[model samples]
Target: MRIMLDIGHPKDVNVFKNVILSLQEMGHTVKIFVRAKESTKRMLDDAGFEYEVCPYYKSMAGKAFGILANDLRLYMIARKFKPDVFVSPGSPYSAHVSSLMRKPHLAFSDTEIAGLVTMLTLPFTDKIYTSTSFYLDLGPKQERFKGYYELAYLHPKYFKPNKSVLDKYGLEEGYILLRLSALSSHHDLHASGFDFETEDELRDYISSLEKYGRVIISSEKLDWDTIKEYQLDLDPDDLHDIINYASICLSEGATMASEAAVLGIPSIYVSNTERGYLNELETEYDLVYNIPDRGEALEKTISFLQNKNTKDEWQSKKVVMLNHNIDVCNFIIDRIINIDKRGL
Candidate 1:
């Protein structure tokens, strides 16, 4: 079987990496198409996967125009590859091109708030897969799965925490990991996080975290001289290892927050927007705290930091979560094979 996978976000690389390897091991030809977004190329290169880089637009006007431009680019690529099916994390370009080629397009989506992308992509998609916790119902073509996209790579069967990553970065066991996302994506147009008035205020807030433990900051678009010393300077591939050993994760990004939760680390997600998976992790499993208000989120963070049994309690919660969910990479591979065999 010839399968074509499209990567629209940096996280998509991790989501598809294990699936790609498993498919190739099973003697299937796999081709990857990635957008020129932050860290997407670097991750693909480090993983040693051969992929083609597609064009992407950063500005709103460019993004509107990019729909047609990227659709044409992917259409040309699909024409040459002649894939059996197209798969992505709700990528409209793949959905549009696959439809034009008369091939089935399967999309896996978790963000219920990305209305524009869903509007453009789902109509062209043959099947749209989402986590069972997802809020919206996409009619008959939607399929609900029992696990998260993070589990495709971060499941215990695939990932093991390496304590060596801590020593390499001179980090102690209980260091706090802080992720400050730019929140510049299309879906994040109206979203907000970490309501600091200025860079100095943000720096001051980070400094306060050091009183509890060492703080390592990872920012997507940080250029402030005040927080330069605390900025994380490690390879992107080793991020999970860092997250695995952190005392707690404070992230403005939903993906990183959920990653920490799955690893059994207590996470505080500070965002106005909510994802159903994060809500489940917070309300059902008690592994994550999804607080929209910055003050409330900080209070929760300090509470977790001061508690001695938080980590152990989170690990117990993680076991329950694992028991309820499937190994997502294996699920994706098996589903793709079945889709091919059934000619669906």
Candidate 2:
């Protein structure tokens, strides 16, 4: 079967890499259409995947216009490629294009609060897959999976830690991995993230972590003047390696926090946005601490770091979580093939 997969973010690329390979091995022709946003295209290049770049616009009006342009572009490309089905990580463009092409559209989303995209895409999508912990309803079109969207790629069967990455980066033991996202995405319009207004609070968080170990800051927007020496600089693919070996992970990004949790790393997630994925990781897995503000995040970080059995406890919880959840890649492949074969 011919398949068209849309790559909207680096996270989407990661989620579908193994799925694409498996599909190709099964003699399926797969065409990837990706957005040229951040390091998404770079990672696709590094992975040696053939893809066409879709332009991104920064301004609201530009983005709105770009959506129409991209929709038409995707429709034209899919018309030429003649794919049997279309898939993406909750992309409205894919939904629109597939609708025009009269092809089935399958979308996967873990975020319950992506209101704009959900409203625009779900009506056109043939099927919507979401985590069982997802807090929203999509009527009869929604299918619930026991595992997270991250498990599609990051499950232990597919990913192995590269300890050599530690030596290559000259990373010290017990370093805290810090990720600061741009928070400028459409869904993040009114979201609160990493209270940076009070520089003292930010400094205090770093200083407190410094006492336990080195603080490695990875910021998408601003560099911390005080921790300039510890800024992370490396290939985007090597990030998981560093994350696996880190003593702790703190991020304003939902994806990073969930990634850390699945890797059995203790994570302190700071954001006003509440995700069912993170909530399940926190309540059931006990691997992530989701705090609403910087003050509470600092307190939780200290508590997590101070616990001597943090790593062991989280790893044990990870084992239990893995035992209960299905291998997500197998599920994805099975469903895609089943749909294509049955013409469902």
Candidate 3:
């Protein structure tokens, strides 16, 4: 069978990398279409997958046009590739293009709060896979799975932490991972992330974290002219390895917060929008804290770090989470190979 997979973000690459490789190993041909997200193309290149570039525009004004243009380009590629199926991490372009091409479109998603993406993609998609804890109703097309999309890659069966990441980055002692995301995506239209009133506020925030140990900042938008020394410049794949060994993880990204939680690391997520996965991580697992502002975020960070048993507590919670979840990569591979079994 010939499969067409679309990667819209760096996280989508991680979500589907195992599935793409396993399908190829099983004598199936896979074609990848990727958007130029941060380090997305780089990761695909590193993994040795030859893919076609789908052009993307950065400005909000050109977004709708970009989506339409990409959809048309993808439609043209689908016609030439003659794929048996189409798959993505809930991309509207893939869903619309596959529907027009009369191919089965399987969308894997966990962001129930992304109403705009869901509304545009679901009607055209053949199947929508989501975690069992997902909050919103996705109608009859929804297929509930036991684990998150992140588990497809982060699970022990698929990923092993490379401790050499510490030696490679010269990170020997305790350190904190700070993530500042550019919350300017279509889904994040009204959302705010890690906002500060001034440069002084931002500098003060970073300074406060110094008491715990070293602060490594990973930003999607900030240009960090004053603190370039603290900015992280590692590969996306290596970042997870660093997350595994971090003293604490603080991010404006909901996805990274969950990634840190699943790896037995305590994460402080500062975002205006709440997600189902983060809620589960916080309430059920007690591994993540969702703070909407810098003041409360710093307060929680200090309280969390001050507790000497925080790591042990988070590790116990992670075991409970793992025991309840399925091997997501295995489930994904099986679904792709025997999609008819799901009555699609």
User: Which predicted model would earn the best TM-score?
Assistant: 1
Model 1 error, position 42 (Å): 0.8
Query: Residues 1-344, candidate 3, lDDT per residue (tens digit)?
Result: 89989877888888888888888889999999988764899999988999988876676777778779899989988899999989888988899999888889998888877787788889999998888889988899988988787888988887898888898888964588888888867778888877865767778888999988889887786566634667867887797898899989999988889899999998989998988888887888888998888789888998888999988998899999999999999888887889877777
Span of ten consecutive residues with least summed lDDT in model 2: 221-230
Backbone clashes in model 2, listed as residue pairs: none
lDDT (CA) per prediction: 0.89, 0.85, 0.85
Residue 127, candidate 2: C-alpha displacement in angstroms: 0.3
Q: State the lDDT at 58 in candidate 1.
A: 82
Global fold similarity of model 2 (TM-score): 0.96
| Clash totals, every prediction | 0, 0, 0
Instruction: Estimate candidate 2's alpha-carbon lDDT, on a 0 to 1 scale.
Output: 0.85
Q: Candidate 1 or 3, higher TM-score?
A: 1
Residue pairs of candidate 3 with colliding backbone atoms: none
The Cα error of candidate 2 at residue 102, in Å, is 0.9
Q: How high is each candidate's TM-score? A: 0.98, 0.96, 0.97
Residue-wise lDDT of candidate 2 within 1-344, one digit each (tens)? 99899877788888888999999999998899988786888888888899977898766677688889999889888889998889888899999988887889998887787888799899899999888989898899899999987888779898988888888888865789888888877777777778686656678778887888888987776555644556767789898888888888999999999998998899888889989989988898788989878777777887878889988988898898888788888888887878957555
RMSD of each: 1.1, 1.5, 1.3
Provide the lowest-lDDT 10-residue window in model 1: 221-230
Candidate 2 lDDT at 268 equals 81
